[model samples]
Target: MANAFERLVEKMDRATLDRMGKPVLINDVGFVAVESHLIPEMGPLTGDGISLVIFSSDYKPRRNDQTVWDGQSYIVTRYQSFNGKPQVWLE
Candidate 1:
């Protein structure tokens, strides 16, 4: 597969923070992404990937138990809730 910084111009289903602790949405805010970086996360796996983004403000995921990226499908691996504010998992 190829890798490049693609821009997402739409609201994503789930918004969370990346390895860099940045606010990253599936397809919101139109940020730059790498195919090699996110493509792997597009599948079904039983592990967690390191954070990539550096913005953590409005991260409210739907579920959490075991986030997996199997290359073709994805699954929730953990669950985290928010309180009407922006919160990121730093440190």
Candidate 2:
């Protein structure tokens, strides 16, 4: 199987992302292996089809729209002056 870093390198390419259609996140939460698939979101502002990742010690996913009221969604909470306010979504 491809390691998580390899997967990210391949998937994060702009060309790759554009062609792959929208990404759908399905979390079995606590499952042992990773299995990703594509799904169409019913509407906008619900979340996006593309997946954004934030990895730390492990490639723990916080798939699109998966955030709960605990409040760790993709929404940017802070701002920056000169450059992109968005943090490097990956650690």
C-alpha lDDT of all candidate models, in order: 0.31, 0.31
Q: Which stretches of candidate 1 lie over 4 Å from their true place?
A: 1-54, 64-72, 80-91
Model 2, span 1-91: residue lDDT tens: 9999877765654444355433322232321111122355633433333223222223333324242222223332322221111112211
lDDT of 1 by residue, 3-73 (tens): 34222211231333222222234323323221123355588744544322322344344433122222222
Candidate 2: regions farther than 4 A off: 1-12, 26-59, 62-91
List TM-scores for all candidates, in order. 0.23, 0.19
Please give the TM-score that candidate 1 achieves against the real structure. 0.23
